[model samples]
Target: MDIPFIDLDAQEKVIGKKLEGAVETVLQHKKFINGPEVSVFEESLAKFANVNNAITCGSGTDALLLPLMAIGVGEGDAVFVPSFTFVATAEVVSLLKATPFFVDVDMKTFNIDPEILRNAIIASKKMGLKPKVIIPVDLFGQPACYDQINEIAEEFSLNVISDAAQSFGAKQGGKPVGGLAHITSTSFFPSKPLGCYGDGGAILTDDKPLAENLMSLRAHGSGKNKYDNVRIGLNSRLDTIQAAILIEKINILKNEIEKRNLVAKKYSEEIDKKIQKPIINNGNYSAWAQYTIIYENRDQLSEYLKDKGIPTVIYYPKPLHLQSAYTVFPRYPKNLKVSEFLSSKVLSLPMHPYLSSAQQNFIISSINKYTKEK
Candidate 1:
């Protein structure tokens, strides 16, 4: 029995006919770029996220870029972000020639720590860099501690960008993750919880002016008309075909999220208590992007599971601040202990809505057997 890390084929089989129909509609219309389907999907996404506007773009990186460009995040601007997240969060800031200051995350939540964020802001100011933005990531699938993060942002007069690339279907305090920040960016990469067939992304915001700016930024800075280029921008429109497929996927996303949660719950219940499981805060819900756990000997455990034909992965083997490309950026001055520690111990097991009871039992028993033998 081969267990998949993420059973995308199982999900595709469930929605294959609807997906084919959507693609066929796009093929017949032939309005491939910026077609009617794009707007429809954007509207649907905005409604689902409970945001006033949603701007679709080419990829999650582009989703992060548009907002930075819209708000003038350029050279010398200090952009704060968690070191534990995917590089794209900091990559976008670096692309704009801005300085990315790394902040460590809370060990339990695997999200940015607000107290450290305040200290980072103060440190940035002391270094003569203008503090501008805070990009808090919803690492794995859970929403960050937004209540405290928002307060810190307000105190420092910093704009917040929620990196919802992995947490789109998650919620905190009964509100969707996308609506928790000034601007939220999400991916539609094939592996995301509410993914499309190919690369895609969207930006959600309540500010109309910013939404207009995002639309302009995603299309070579077009203004009023296509030929009228106003500002420097990238050609990053989310294609119509992907949008059409996303429509079908989004309709069933709620059920999929519930199923993923069920899978996560079972892992917590049955996996060895010595392995630190993902922690979700009260009134918060994760999309369960990856059911990650931390153990002392993560490499040995991963290899052991691999030998058993159970796939596993590490979210980030090294913190963003320690990466070679990011070595020049300013950090918290003190060591980011938690981020660095998590980098050494985190392991993501098989997690998806379609994972079976038998498959999960095998994975659980295999792990229990290994730990006991050790």
Candidate 2:
């Protein structure tokens, strides 16, 4: 049988019956937008995340943008984000007409390096740009250094918007990823830890006023009612069916996350240092969304894995500073040594909650054999 990087089918088989009935309920009601399922899902999500508010949106991108829009972060402002992250983290900042001050990341965790963040803020101030927001992505389901990041934000009086797109159900310092900072965003993109069958995401916060604004911002910036448009906003509401699927899946999300952790532990214990493994920091419990590794020769390692009937992926082969669209920005930093190094060496292996013991051994054995041959 062909191996899948993520075994969505294995999960479906376990929860198919429960999900079927939920889908049937939605069909029976014929409510596909802003329906009861959406409400229930939001309530459950807020509870799960330990947040007072949760606003569902169309996608992970919306999860980041809606909070910025609601918070009134706009032109003449700058948002601090790591260039090592997915484009969405910086893209939302740029979309609001706010300049993105690219920061470097910690090599092992692959999250924003707090020291680089402080330096970027100082540099931006020196250049006469006002830094207003900070967005840290929880890349690969491990929460960033939130304690230090939030402390730095407080000292600078900058708003923190955590990009938890890959980190739903994750924990850092005994608290859930959502509701840790001023605002947290997470995705339910079919491959995420707590994914729906389609695109979906949510913004979580304990701030009521912020929550109210997020609700308005989600529906074209309407006031009190859908017809009363008050501000310029994009259409980014979560569909009821997707919400329903999420609700059904939410029942098993915790179990799935636990299973993902076991898989990660196995790789960490068994995989030799020839394949530099990702680091799980102290007091942080990752959802293990993607077990990415940095090898000495990424391209050669990838080829070897493929020849052994094992697939591989590159989380990113290029840093944001190297991307064409972001090149036009003024005063771009020149020496992001860690980001450049990671871009060349990073590769992700086939990882999922349902990977069998035999398959795991096969992958490790294959790597050992290939490295010896080379």
Candidate 3:
């Protein structure tokens, strides 16, 4: 039995008809750019996230970039983010000429550590840079320690941005992630929990002024109209076709999230003890994007799984500060022990809402065999 990772084909089969209808409607209308369907999709997204406003963009990177531009994040500004996440989280900071001060994440949750965040802010100030924004990543679909992060941000008078790129369908304290901070950004990449057929993303916020700014920034900084440009901005509009595709998927996202949670629970319960399973906090619900686990010999274990016709992946093999592009940036907690440690040990198993019981049992059995043999 060949096992695959992130079976997008399975999900496509479930939503294909609705997806086809949506795309056909867009094609018939001939309103490819900022079509009426785009607005409908944005409205549906905002309603689902329970936020007052949702602004769509070209991709997840643009979703992060638009917020920084709208908030005037520029040269010499310090943006604190986790080192353990995808480079895009900190890449945007550097793109704007702002400095990205990499902060370490908690070993258990794989999200930003609030205590280290406070220390990073102090360090940035000492280095003569203005601490502007705190971007906490929701790694592997688990929401970050937002309440604690928000409190620390407030005490320091820093703006908080929830990088819900992975945790779009997740919840913390019974509240959804999009409204967890001053601004929230999520990816609609084809592999994300709530993905479109192609590249897409959205920004969610309760602040009307900020939402309006984002709308302008998404275009060529259009003011009143595209002909009248107010500020320098990138061409970052979400394609109408992708918006149409996402509209159909969003309808059944809740059911998908529930199924993902069940899969994560089963993996945690049955995986070998030598493997450190994901630790989701009480009152926090994950979207279970990756179902990653930590093991001392991750590479060997991964090879063993591959030999059995089971595919696996590594979420990250290197921390941001250690990456070639970010080597010049500073990292907090000087040692950066947690982020570096996680990078070497973390390995993601095949995970998706459509993973069957038989496949899961096979995966668990293989891991048990490998551990016992060792």
Over the stretch 1-374, how does candidate 3's per-residue lDDT look in tens digits?
88889888888899888889999999999899999889999999999889999999998888999999988999999999999999899999999999999999999999999999999999999999999999999999999998899999899888998899999999999898798999999999988999987888999999999999899888888899989999888898888998889889999999999999999989999998988999999999999889999999999999999999999999899999999989899889887999999999999999999999999999999999999999
lDDT of model 2 at residue 123?
87
**Model 1 lDDT tens row, 1-374:** 79989998999899999999999999999999989999999999999999999999999999998899988998889999999999999999999999999998999999999889999999999999999999999998899988898899898899999999999999999999789998999999888998887899999999999999888888899998999999998999999999999999999998999999999999999988878888898989999998999999989999999998999999999999999999889888479999999999999999999999999999999998888888
Which residue pairs in candidate 3 collide? none
Segments in model 2 whose C-alpha atoms lie over 4 Å from true places: 330-333
For model 3, state the Cα shift of residue 336 in Å. 0.5
For candidate 2, give the lDDT. 0.87
lDDT of each: 0.93, 0.87, 0.92
Q: At residue 113, give the lDDT of candidate 2.
A: 93
- Cα deviation in Å at residue 35, candidate 3? 1.0
**In lDDT terms, how accurate is model 1?**
0.93
Tens-digit lDDT string for candidate 2 (87-134): 988888889998888888899899999988888888889888898999
